[model samples]
Target: MSLPRYQEYKNSGVAWLGNIPRHWEAVFLKRVIKAIDSGVSVNSIDTPAEENELGVLKTSCVYRGEFDPSENKAVIPEEHDRLACPVRAGTVIVSRMNTPELVGAAGVVRQNIDNLFLPDRLWQVHFKDAVPAYVHYWCQTPIYRAQVQSACAGTSSSMQNLSQDEFRRFVLALPPIREQSAIATFLDRETAKIDGLIAQQEKLIALLAEKRQATISHAITKGLNPAAPMKDSGVAWLGEVPAHWRVGKIQNFAKRESGHTPSRQHPEWWENCTIPWFTLADVWQLRTDNVKFVYETKELVSELGLANSSARLLPAGTVMLSRTASVGYSAIMGCDMATTQDFINWVCKPELTSDFLLYVLRGMRTEFDRLMMGSTHQTIYMPDVAKLMMGLPPIEEQAFIVSFLDTEITRLDALTAEATRGIALLKERRSALISAAVTGKIDVRLS
Candidate 1:
């Protein structure tokens, strides 16, 4: 798959561009661009659907390599005139402000678009000679990105801004117009092939997740033997269970508890904290890698903070379910921890297994979401969760179910991990290929 190289090379006198094709010219962007315009600052926030005439492009609109109309922030009709001229097909756009990793992301509109205004944080330019797609691809190169990143600064840690003056003076390594068109066409074909492969891997990961969920849901609800006798559990969501299994409310099996946060005003309350303070942030950690054990948390509270607040300290193996904001995510505490009110935890009785309760709750995530919606709620209340009914099996059967799931899920996890790695490698190759072709390390003009 190696491509041919140009016959001759010459030094470009730029750090990022050690050498280029002898025929190519390295010049300032200001010399080749007909005009560079920045969008107006529209101090407005409204839903996209509410404004039909036009919307303002969010700084994120061009944050990636492609034009994303969905990232637009809706603006009122009165603000439409703020843009000097509406964006058109084949216009090169760049982000003037973003994190170092994403600053200077550029894309070209592929079609004639209407009713979309640009934000002040973006730059729109028309090339006097070079192709828009060629410049767009240039902006994605590591050398160009590194140059932009070196010039950007931020008032706050989260913000990085590229000034217009610095951008205008930036130099570009350019090919003749005909060569630019050929390179752009070649990249469009090659990257699309790579993107298709990445999409297939993504589909595989999704299918594995679906199969895993179904396996867990069936094992927990239907018991180990499919042919076992069945009986109605009286829970509408859960139709029936094994005849020998018992059905009971969540409260019947465990004691429900909540948590609280200490005031931020008291710095002394949090100083040199030693006790594990669990909050909603732990739910995200669990979602990241399907993390099951909360062996550690992002923050810890001092004994003073815990004593000053209503936070309750619970032992290891307690099952915690989110009840506010991002509801339904659950995790088991791997160690004794104090928590915030965003969660409703369960301390299982000796007769009932904590592993069994955790499975039942995890299986009920979808049901929790459904119930949360039925109540028209942004958060699930404690009373509604307390009433959730689950089918219970003997302690031996509970242990068997957990063991079987652990083995089967681990096997599927391996397959999923392989697919994830495949996607990552494909992405790395795509970036490298683009950088090599656009920077003239390889010649892409031939079929």
Candidate 2:
């Protein structure tokens, strides 16, 4: 699509912002604004210290365009006296040392607290004459964020930071203060409305998910016979269940087994393995329609041991449960697949349907955590999971439960997806409005 002629002239060649007003001039950030390190470090702040003094601003407290004082830490003792670069109201503080995506998160200091100090990892900018709010919004744009990401340098898990000198070199278009204020006001109102819509959609999605879970849990445990006599299950989360249901160990109806990892150093053994290897990342999505890689049967037989075989492919009806990290997530194997030692595969007995067992496992997710062991990372051992007590019903009733839940939950999922899409469209409209207003494509200035 062709851009308007005016947009063509102002195009700094940055795709996110097509063009600017003909009267405006684009310049390096260093030429327009002064960057200050505000060398007040907050490393030694004592938590138990007096609350009367101004709290230190940590990198985390400044996000987007607001100061979250609730997350601020106490000022360190030695650096308290050196707090000369105290950030006053209207100063824009940008995070210099965060993840690439989070770097350059700009927040405006709209209010002042006594003795407030900015941390070393942040850059405080004082605009020569441009609106601070305008600078904040510009920094948040996609074009500016791309520049910040390119400026970052680091190899570790955490992205390294950019210096004050690097930030000063950032290039952006400048408009008059009157125009800047008009742009800021237009964005403030439009973005708020967009955010409100997104929030409402998010809340609706959460409600739908909750309803879906409750519906499945109710059907699997209580059965379709609503008139059945109910009895107290003795669990607070699960109040009362059908009186006829029998409470017993999960191991009674299913076999609980763990998996193992083959040595990666042996290229000969690892190569051509027909067995499909599964990891934590595989279980990230509830639906198992895709996998990263697969192994050959010959490699599995020649070099893989029984423990490595712990990841042996189970039948299509098998139920898999994550035992670490994102604990308690469960899914029924749509096809045969092997998993890591971090997972426990529950193969249902002939008496129980795998679909019914999947729902049962979902209901028992909380109980699984209660039986977990280990200090740092909680885990459910084979014995702990095998011995889990559960209430079971007749086979015929189990089939009824699965069929009823399948139809109801699908409807709820559809509604949630529609709501999510609506929110996304609203956000797109909000961004387009901001870009148009700032670039003078849509004039917000009153004559």
Candidate 3:
């Protein structure tokens, strides 16, 4: 997939665009025949506008050099007068104010939009001489991103502002009109092939995850021997279980404990921290790293902090379930630790093991979704958690199930990791292809 370089080249005097085809021209953005117009901010609802209604664009409308008209909100009738910058074809929409990484993102529209208006954080560039698609692709290159990063302004690092003057000063290496169209067409075709491969890998990853969850649910609900006699478990989610398995409330087999945070106002309580503290911050380890046991925590609490607060130093092997904010994630504690109020801890009795309980919790994702409450922040209240039930297998069977699941999960995780790596490589190739084509690093006229 390599293309031939141009016959002759010359330095453009710009660091990003080191060398260009002899016939190509490199010029500041303002030199092109165009006028940049910005839009005014308006009050709008979160819902997108209907075909007959007017809408105001959101900062998310442009991503990765692509335009999404649907990423806009419905504008009420009163704010229609403030909507001056109407979305039009043959123009580029650039985000003028956003987070540092996305401040100068731009996209080109392929068709004339009727009722969509830009917001104050966006600017519309109407090109008179340059090809809109070429300019859009150029905006995605690292060259444009570096320049935008250097020229960005704002008091805070999270949100950056890009001025029209600074944006216009961006320089691009341009080819003739026919060559520009050819390059854009070449990218559209080649990138589509790469995108299709990436999509297949993503779908494979999703299917592997579903299979992993199903495997866990099946092993925990039914015994390894399919011929084992079955009986009604009484619970709707736990339809039936092995005849010999014991069925009862979850609280009967384990002691349910809640977590608490130390008072921030007491400065002395926070000093000289030693004990490991499990809080919502450490849930990311379970969510992404796919680890079954939590050995370390992001923060630690002092003995004074534990004494002053309602927190308790639970022993190793305690099962921790995040009950609020980020709910449903569970793991076994690898060492003695205290926790914040965000988790629901459990100490299994002699009849149940912590590893077995961890599997049961993971298998009950549907039940978690059903019992969770609240609009903005969902939580599994103590009362609902107390009423939960499970089918208890024999100790030997519980140990066997844990061992079988550990093996299966390891295989699935390896497959998922491979697919994820494939996606990363595809994205890198896409970015490199776009950068090389837009900057004349590789001649794409005949690609």
Candidate 4:
């Protein structure tokens, strides 16, 4: 997929800029930037009081190379000194503070957005003469990212702060402004086609997930033999089940428990802990495609932290469902682990196995979400969960259902994995195409 090169070439005397088309010039970003400054400093609130008041934009807005007014944090007053800075169409915004990979991510403002203020961690620049879209495309290049990474300074590994002076001096090869605009237009057309293909793959994944859940739900509620005698289960989500099936609240068969966090202020409680303490983030990792078991967590707690708090290490077979944010997500413990109060822990009885309960919870997520629709935050209260009725067959039949689902879902998972890889390759191709075009590796004026 290599593209045609320029008719003639000359070294730019810069390692990143490489050999530019002989007709073009390699210049510092500062040479084309008219004005560059950081945004205002303000405390951000999760949900803004109103949509119209001044809001602070997170670095993520620029990181994605798109302007999403919705990702703002509510700030009462965007001070005129820095916060009230007006944002106009064509302004190039780059994040001053982000992870090393995304620190210098930039995008152009395509429309006149209202009531949005920039944070001190983001920089909005106005080009003296260069096209905003052209500079934005440069920001997407590995060359630009490498320079940003080298200049980034940070005391902690998780965070990175971009050096403004060094970034402004970042070199890029440029063509005439008209050629730049043409190249940008060419990219807009090419990228839209790639994006369409990626979107189609995503929609397919969603459909496959729905089909998988339906299969699990049907099997869990009714025995594999459809001709089996049916009886009223007296539950909305689970309408009718096999006549011989037992129906009751989960608490009837499983021992329900929860965990807690130790006080952060007490060093003695957390300083030297070896216990795996699970958080909501850990639950999310376990929910990733093909992730079935959670053997460990992101953070560990001290023995004192476990003793002082309500945390209790559970056996490997215990099933946990997220009770707070990300409600209804469930996973089984692959090894001994403790969790926070955000989960409802279930120790399965001899009659109800962990695998059966896991599938049941996984299938009934839609019902849990429906029941909790009115709440400001989606959280399934423990009492409501305790009242959830599930139909259960004999232990042998339960094992059969679990085994069938395990094999069926794994087959579907493989197809999904293939589609996911295709999407990734498409995205990489998209980025590479853009990089080649903007760096003079390919001429798009004739595109």
- Best candidate according to lDDT: 3
- In the order shown, the candidates' Cα RMSDs to the true structure are 2.6, 4.6, 1.6, 4.1
Give candidate 4 regions above 4 Å deviation: 37-58, 73-83, 114-119, 154-159, 257-285, 297-315, 324-327, 335-343, 370-381
Candidate 3 clash figure, as a count:
0
Q: Which parts of model 3 have CA positions greater than 4 angstroms off?
A: 153-155
Poorly placed runs, candidate 1 (over 4 Å):
43-52, 78-84, 263-272, 373-377
Better of 3 and 4 by TM-score: 3
Per residue, candidate 1 scores C-alpha lDDT tens digits across 179-259 of 999999998999899999999999999999998888888887898898899999898766788999989898788988889
Tens digits of lDDT, candidate 3, 1-447: 898788899999887678988899889998774888788989999899999999999989996568899999999899887788889998999998889988999999999898999898999898867889988888888899988998985446999888888988889998988899999899889888999999999999999999998998888888788999999998998888999999998789999888999999998888999999988889887575368898899898999999988879999999988889888889999999988988988999999999999999898889999999998899999898889898899899999999999999999999999999999999999999989898787888866
Better of 1 and 2 by TM-score: 1
Q: On residues 319-436, what C-alpha lDDT tens digit does candidate 4 reach at each position? A: 8888777778888888888999988889999999999998888889678877574356678877787787799889999999999999989988887888899899998998999899
Error of 2 at 389 (Å): 2.4
lDDT measured at residue 82 in model 3 versus the true structure, 0 to 100: 76
As for model 3, its CA RMSD to the true structure in angstroms is: 1.6
Model 1 poorest 10 in a row by lDDT: 43-52
lDDT of 1 at 165: 76
lDDT by residue for model 2 (1-447), tens? 122323435565655555767777677887768546564565555452355765667777676445565556666666577665666777788887787667778877777655566777777778777788877777766667777876775534476687777788887777788888877886787688788888999999899878877787777667788799999877554568899887666778888767666667665656555655567666565432121112222124223533444456666667778887767777776656666787887788877777777777777655766877777887777776666666778888888787787778778878987997998898678767655665556656652
**Candidate 3 TM-score over all chains jointly:** 0.96
State residue 87's C-alpha deviation in candidate 3, in Å.
1.0
List the global CA lDDT of all models: 0.82, 0.69, 0.89, 0.83
- Model 2 CA lDDT for position 26: 74
